[model samples]
Target: MTTEHTGTPRPSDAELARIAAELRALGEPEFDAELEATPVASLVRELAVPTAFALAFGPTDSALPAGAADPAGAGGLLDVAPLTELDRARVWRKIVARRSGGAAQHHGPRAPSWRATWVAVATAAGLALVPVLSTPDRAATPAGRAAAEALGSQARAALEGVPGEQDGGRAAELAAQYSARLSSSGSEAPR
Candidate 1:
């Protein structure tokens, strides 16, 4: 007599339990293989060259040589003659003299106008009153101070609990473990 086997293979209870335990114990996979395969160096070079070029050339506007609306002529459109060292020095002296003359005229003795005097007094009064009006009256109540202190203490405690230095290292390790597990198990972890 011939015997026939039918239907799908059924996993035993023990086998199922073992599989679940393995799943729980597994962490993320090492993504080193994928990272190694990636052309990270080339990508870095690609990103750096353009950024450096942009910085060296300044902004891409009318100010830049390439970004100019018209590039047919050498230098800029302005036809101002190039100044010699002597010419520049003379021009500088004239500008200085004009500025000094203006300053002397303004500072020379003069009676203050009624409108100017009142305006100066009003401006001084406003400046004096600003700090007084803007400053919050912290001494107005004891309850407000107590609440602020309590909130500050709570924030300090929360900040203290954070593992500052080891945070990035721990995160990287966790990510690697997760990737490894997902790869081995052939399942995508939920986001």
Candidate 2:
């Protein structure tokens, strides 16, 4: 039955889902007799030449073909001189250079800057201090005092173990003793 146009607005999601379900219920469509009889190869052969011509010459329906020969000698591509051997070599070199990242290297490596050096130094210093910062304050603890005494004893033993006479053995021994005392006293001030 022919229904007159209702001029309805866009269908809702529900309407669309219903339409889709109806379409899915239908099996594969049967081609008309004429279309069924037409060979695909024959169609391709018929259109191939025209398609190639249209592609090469641009759209055929236009009044003048695209890139049509300029009449007033506006210096089209045909007028240009062929590349010389040197020109060809230069072009090839440029292409190879670009492919090999040589084009990027034209500016060369960046020179070391004072700011970058300072940043690197600061980073290294921060990294060096990380262990020191992460460790808990041990100077006030009894364990720290025992550790300092052990270190001082080890240092004295190490000094005695040396075969040759030390230049400032007395001074070194005194410094070790002082360091141990300072560690046990929980004194933050540098001696």
State the C-alpha lDDT per candidate: 0.39, 0.39
- Error (Å) of candidate 2 at residue 190 is 47
Question: Per-residue lDDT of 116-190 in model 1, one digit per residue for the tens?
Answer: 788999999999999999998768367887898899999999988986545798788888888888878877763
What does candidate 2's lDDT look like per residue over 80-141, in tens digits? 23334554454335334442442233333433354568899999999999998999875557
Q: Model 1 lDDT vs. the true structure?
A: 0.39
Error of 2 at 133 (Å): 4.5
> TM-score of each candidate?
0.24, 0.20
Candidate 2: list runs displaced more than 4 Å.
1-75, 102-129, 132-191
- Model 1 misplacement above 4 A: 1-112, 138-140, 166-191
Superposed by TM-score, candidate 1 places the C-alpha of residue 84 at a distance from the truth, in angstroms, of 73
As a TM-score, model 2 comes out at 0.20
